[model samples]
Target: MKLLLLNLIFLSGSAAAVELNADGILNSLIDEFVSCVNDSAGPIHQAAMRLFWLLVPINLVISGIRCVFNGDFSDFFFSLVTSVLFTGIFYYLLSHDYAIGKSIIDSFVTMVDDDYMGPSELIDLVFNIDRQINNLMTSNVLGLVSKLQIVICMIVFSVVMFFVILRFVSIYLTAQILCVIGVFVLGFGGLKATRYLAVNYLKLLISKGLELITVLIITKTGCRILNDVIDATKLYEEGLSVLKHSECMVMIFISLFIFVLSKSLPPVMSSLMSGTSGGFETGLGLSLKKYRFLISRNSGK
Candidate 1:
């Protein structure tokens, strides 16, 4: 059910991208990104590790600054480290033998082919894919499906573990945060000093998530637009395609706009609220309440 909701959310304004055979591309990207970072760290691996840890927070601070200026933060839960994980996973998904890229193209083609029955076509595509998947499940000769499911489960488990580790680290860091607050209370006796740290940390988190989501949305949108632009010349000869389908194109554009807006708004709101004296506390509380309401509403839906 959660997966279904995530899929819907991801597909809200956009069609799924084409399933490119991107295994090589994924590995290459990971290697390049990692190697660049490592090269920047010089010869010693331990020194590199320390520098990387230090740099991660700096990146988050940078993201926060960018978010403040932009007034839009979406998907900021993903920090620099987590964003790297996400990017790697994304690259893997795009590069792997997953026919997601092809499926995306097929969807576009199908949508374009039958303009009048867009909804019905979507349903048919779902069911057709479902039928094929069911057949694969029932056959199970190569155990490919089972292996894939296990891999997915492992990925999910790893994510859960990451969150668990993050929680522990946050808890461990709380003592230092409190110590700083303690010193402030003792030195000049200002409780407001504590507020600064708390607010900044919260801003950091919001900014990070927003930036990560922004990257994902931007990359995905770029891919879709590029594909459409490239296919423009051959769209006529290619029979029905997304670019040829006005309705789909409109939907895609609207969806992308919403994605960009949603990602941008949160951090802007956070930054604005933080700038005022009591605004951060009030806004943070309200945001939390609103988020709770949203979760409840979505859950019910």
Candidate 2:
């Protein structure tokens, strides 16, 4: 594991020295990964479509019966039209392997604060951090305690980085699965009793988008962690208090905040989204929620 970290794709001797290829993190992996997801989801999509086609008529008949008793002719017509329309949309998205899914995530990532570092900047920061660690180790810089601090910070910091990447892949995989199975989910809209299933699925998509944005924001620019590491190192060189200059404890807190609590971000945002009217109609089903609270407070005043 230590060897892997030292030789990590971006953490190598230099950032520009490497290119992602078949032997490493290749572009084909994403294409092939999506291909695999589509292949796996194909059968599921077929089954869902078949079942939906079979059941959609039954649901509409049931809804029509209910509408007759309630004397809601408008409601019957509305349900009939919306069921077919929503199902068609679901089928179309599933057929495309959720191409717009990633686009949504990318849009969320871009919605982050302008001053925050991006993926490219994050990569460069990691490279500089790796070099800094080597520099402190090779030179006669600090006392034993000071060097130990760097080691502790690096270990915790590296774990956070690993989890960020892992969470990203996990999000991508889940979004594809949800997009595919959403055929039946949206098909549930044909009946009033099951309409919430389709609505919740849409909510879940918004939540999933929130999850993707949360992890990226944390690793990309949320904490300024890598900057902290560099700042502490420079302070150590100037003979500051070993404990004071050592931001290892701060590193642990920041890293753990990401590693543990980041999962809650989605559900939290989901709860807030649940409160809003016309969620799906909002376009993207959500605004950039990072600023939503501030937006709310000002409006109330």
Candidate 3:
């Protein structure tokens, strides 16, 4: 009987060790995959950036020609200088690896760390829960309902992370593509349509930057609130057997918030960028309307 008990104990310990090793290997593989993707993408990004700069001189010449035709040397010179300056600034940012999307993500991460609600904490919390579940499984203490809840939470967490990461990558890639194409097209000053396209593209770049920041802010704020609730629940858990239920509620709330933010943030960002309330529309519309009225009056005179 003693020998049988010893054998069982040894087998259990070995099984647990194997499981942990498997998890570690899986995590390492994921890290390597992400690194590989970043390395592969670097050259493509650089090429797009280079092409954008190459088109700047062409755009300047076209703008100069258009201005000369309009008999507006001052406007031509002003546009030339401003366009060059903006292009230079963008070039500096791109060359120095200060990509707007990456910068916003890093800044938000830093802010969350300062507020004691970093993503690392969330990751650790999830892993800890996973560990607990594993232990329960080994000890035969995990009920069917408890196992289901754990599985559901894990699935939800994975889905949220996957979609969030996908959206972020899409936004970053789109911004890069737009910056290249938009700057190149801005050279075609003779086409009124191209000019409008260029302006809209510029607005789009700004919108992308704003959208990233807004999403990060919302996510971080949500995480912080969730963390606070979690901490409060821990205090209450000492006197009650409601920890699992509390955690379930918290996880559900987090998942819902993430879904809502992902679905709603883009539209809010677009509206903000449109300047419907003291933005580009209000200023530009009023200015253009007044300019047209003045032109009509002058023509009548």
**Local distance difference test scores for all models:** 0.36, 0.59, 0.52
Cα shift from native, residue 123, model 1 (Å): 30
lDDT of 2 by residue, 153-184 (tens): 77767667556555555665576667665555
List clash counts for every candidate, in order. Answer: 18, 0, 1
Q: Which stretches of model 1 miss by more than 4 angstroms?
A: 1-195, 233-301
Q: Report the C-alpha lDDT of model 3 over 167-192, residue by residue, as the tens digit.
A: 54445445545544344433332232
TM-score for candidate 2, please give it.
0.62
TM-score list, all predictions: 0.23, 0.62, 0.51
Please report how far candidate 1 places residue 198 from its true position, in Å.
Answer: 4.1
Full candidate order by lDDT, most accurate first: 2, 3, 1
Residue 256, candidate 3: how far off, in angstroms? 1.9
Identify the candidate with maximal lDDT: 2
Please give the distance, in angstroms, between residue 209's alpha carbon in candidate 2 and its true position after superposition. Answer: 1.2
